[model samples]
Target: MATSTGRVTGTARDRAAGADGARGRGRPKKAGPVRRSMSQHWYAWAMVAPVVVVTAALIGWPLVRGVYLSLTDATEATMGRTIGVNVIPSTYGFTGLDNYVDILTSGLFWDKLIWTVVWTVACVGLHYGLGLGLALLLNRKMRLRSVYRLMLILPWAIPSFVAAFIWRYLYNSDYGVINAMLKAAGLGAVGWLDDPTTAKLAVIAVNVWVGVPFMMVAMLGGLQSIPGELYEAAEVDGATPWQRFRHITVPGLRIVSSTVVLLGTIWTFNMFPLIFLITGGGPGSSTEILVTYAYREAFTGIRNYSGSAAWGVIILLLLVVMALVYRRALRKQGEVW
Candidate 1:
């Protein structure tokens, strides 16, 4: 009985080996390419998975929820019901494009939009000019250059809210140092925050002061990266300073300037702290930008959260359009290369 069992086991093993050899010789075993690829990249995917999950949880979910809320009639009264809290026992319903229509039809929205544009353009333009000018001046060999750069950078190093608070006092109507200085100069006290035009200008000036250091630092780095030989060659050719600057300096800094301007525009567009802290979007919303308007809608009286979310979507669309235009401009300039 034992001998018969051993023979049967040996025969089965030999048959299995013969079948495996036949399969290997027939057409070559197929490689599972997709499985192989996944195996190769499993480690990379593992490393990236956490970041992807976190971003989805933090940014993606909120964005999706905001869009949903915008489509619904989700005011302060209905928000609790929508969230399952049922604090006020209200019901919310889909409103489709009503929020957007209302915003578009409102004169206040147009006014804020115009001011937002003016604020962004003016602040970014001044920041670039002041920063580039300072960068060029500092790039020249000068005494106490390090000290001067440090002093210029101090404004950027300070917290923006703190800077806003300090500026608020300076712009005070009565005994503010700025008014005192004007009085000393035989000029009347200017209503910095009180008047509409002056309030807008005052906030812009404060933003410019806070933002210039960043631009200056960026421009300085770009200036340093420029090859000295180019300047030397221009000098040897008897090129005037203005000619050299127009031809060489501006062209050399094109990429840097574009990047700085793009970032500065976005920052200035979304700037909330300075205006909120100093002006409170007050004196009848004179200095209110889109961001401030959205905040007021979401958090202040009435709490029109869905309306605010709609505004946020509009802001996002505007930013997307700006980014696309910038990218197209860069491509046209061959800067992307």
Candidate 2:
């Protein structure tokens, strides 16, 4: 009888403690759905208010304005004009989807888009491949590894525009370093920037030089993050170098590689400085990618403001679609970020 009474009292005390804990946590759940009033979640809304306002001002406003401009007939010459103290009304009229229709109907869009895709793929591929190789080498103990890393990363440390300008001089047809070196080796001086094919390759080389450092750094971080014990354990199991890498290193670096590859693709797709500065979309516009072509439309000769806006919107949509597709693919592979 005494044992039964003690057990009942202990159960009652446990229930009381749970009630106190729930009260300490602010509120308890109801049997059905519970509605939270503004007073209950005011702190959270307050914390989010700044970010919402900033987004609406910067990204939201520009995107909305660009979309609106793409829908209308805006041009640099006819859109709007202003005096010192007067605000001029915008003359651009809405034309629905005419701009998009024109762009889609034209062959130029598809052509430049194809070139852009090729450029993106080539540059990102070289970047990741060379970067991973160098990262793997540098991760091992070696003499002067730090010096080698510093030298390799120097190109990325320099400003991209400066590097582009330097490469342009190096590619000069007469008395350039590259041509001089070719002559020294008894090889005929080939025009690096004059020919369309060579110009495309030249730009890719410059971009790869500038891009690989970032990829190497990211991959190196991923390499270091994989525990040393994992490799040691693999060695103990008599796993070969290739087998251990396939099983452990690749899986461990997946997150880093995924992020860097995505970022590299996006950056390379929109890379303007190297192409614009080096090629100027020359040799009959043979090397012009989508971004450079849009640039030509916006700033060169008679500015097509609405058309350029349409191009911008198109590029934005394409990137969004690519990102969504990439994310879906990653999700399918069980990689969530």
Candidate 3:
């Protein structure tokens, strides 16, 4: 029996070898290792190199040059050695802190800085209040709701320069929509842009109109994110509508609100188009914000390169401070949801 089993195993092995031999030496062997794509091997770098170089040329080079130029007395007419090129210390003299000192000492500079701060705060405040209010109203059930929202958001969706021009005409003392309405109500035409105070208010008003829709949409999204169960619970606890919003709605919107404040502050502080298009920082410079003033100083005024650089540094520092403040506030608020 053992001999028989051994013979059977040998026979099975021979049959398997015969089957393998019958397959005609198996299929032809596959080729060598797979080749990498051209992009995967080298072309990717070639493609991205241009973008990197362009970014460096546009952003990095200018930034570095500006900082370096800030340290020198290079002027519009003296930049390319038009005023005697030299490598000596006396030739390319360093200003050290004099430029900064001069800018800080100027009363107009401080006033412009203050105006920028006040304008940012006021516009941001009104934007927050009005936007939240409108968002809540629009979020409610109503007839023609979409139409109302569209009409309300039209001012913001329009290009700011275009809106500025439209408002400019609307604020005209003779035939402006505002003056016409006022006259219909027996009030005389108010010189919106001709008077200094009114001109500044007009700028703020236009900014508010242009900014509120974005703020409203942001808040509306936040508002809609609140679960209805919270409102149901508030109702069970006998909470009024105001109380429900105060606790539930406001707390739920902390993050979006913070973002709005941060963005609004930056945008308002840096706002230039409306002021430029509408007032041109006029009514005797009563509406000149820091950015416009910087533009004027750099391109219009005595073409002071160092002064403009100093102002740029100051504006950057102020923005940094504002950012830090926002971050600290965010930390204090923590995550609300």
Candidate 4:
């Protein structure tokens, strides 16, 4: 019986091997060319490729060209050609650091830089203070809350150029509403845009007014996301309103506050159209920010392309440094997660 069982097992194993060989012979040996049609995400790539190419052409080319043009004597008027000789000497050749040094050493540039810093700090500080205060007040359930929110956001919703233009008119010396109000109050009409100090202050005020709406909206969003239970816990701990705000609200909003501050700084630093359209960097260039200075260098003052490029490079470096600093500081505070 054992011999019979062994014979049967061997026969079954041989049959299995034979079946495997037969199956292998019946199937094709090679996988025919994959035959992958242009279907799965291939069409999406095809659609986006043109856009990617065009964007690269528009943005990348100009950035690369700007860097190259910075090194050469490229100007809008002249396409960077040597005036007399092909072999240019140091006097006529590429200035390695002169452009940068010129802007750096210029008293006007430093004065503008200092004013720019002061303007940015003041605007950002006021914007956050007023905006967050309003956000907190409006975050509570109140009558006409929606109306107030809409009214608050209207400043931001309006185009910045339009707002700037309106403010410019409002600050006009002769017929401005501001001057009229001052006269009505028995005070002398203030030349808001004529005097250097007044002009700078006026621009900063307009900036703060227009900028606070955005900060308010951002803070309102952040406030809504804070869990009410935290506030309840604070109340249970017998915390005062200020203490609750300091502990729960402020801590919850640290990340948002940092973001708003950084964005406000960048926007305030890059403020151009407002100052240009309103003051035109007049009143002795007191309100000229880096962007306005760069524009003047590029377009007005001898059309110094090298000077403009140097200014652009410096602004880029400053922004990069600020971004790095914010990242480092926020990360240390564990606010960047």
TM-scores, each model vs. reference: 0.86, 0.84, 0.79, 0.81
lDDT of 3: 0.86
By TM-score, the better pick of 1 and 4 is: 1
Query: What's the true lDDT of residue 314 in model 3?
Result: 80
- Residue range 1-337, candidate 2, lDDT tens digits: 9999999999999999999998879875454322354467778888999999998999999888889888988887776778899978877799999999999999999989988999999999999999999899999999998999899889889998999999999998897899999999999998999899999899999999999999998999999999999999999999999999999999999999999999999999999999999889877898898888888988988888888889999999999999999999999999999
Give a tens-digit lDDT track for model 4, residues 246-331: 99999988889998999998988998888998899988777888889889978984676766877887887888898899889888
Flag the better candidate by TM-score, 3 or 4. 4
Separate clash counts for every candidate: 0, 0, 0, 0
Best by lDDT: 1
Candidate 4: which stretches are off by over 4 Å?
Answer: 1-54, 80-93
Span of ten consecutive residues with least summed lDDT in model 1: 79-88
The whole-model lDDT of each prediction reads: 0.92, 0.91, 0.86, 0.86
lDDT of 1: 0.92
Q: Name the lDDT of candidate 4.
A: 0.86
The true-versus-predicted C-alpha distance at residue 99 of model 3, in Å, is 1.4
Off by over 4 Å in 2: 1-55, 83-89
lDDT of 3 by residue, 144-173 (tens): 999999998898879989998999999999
lDDT of 3 at 51: 100
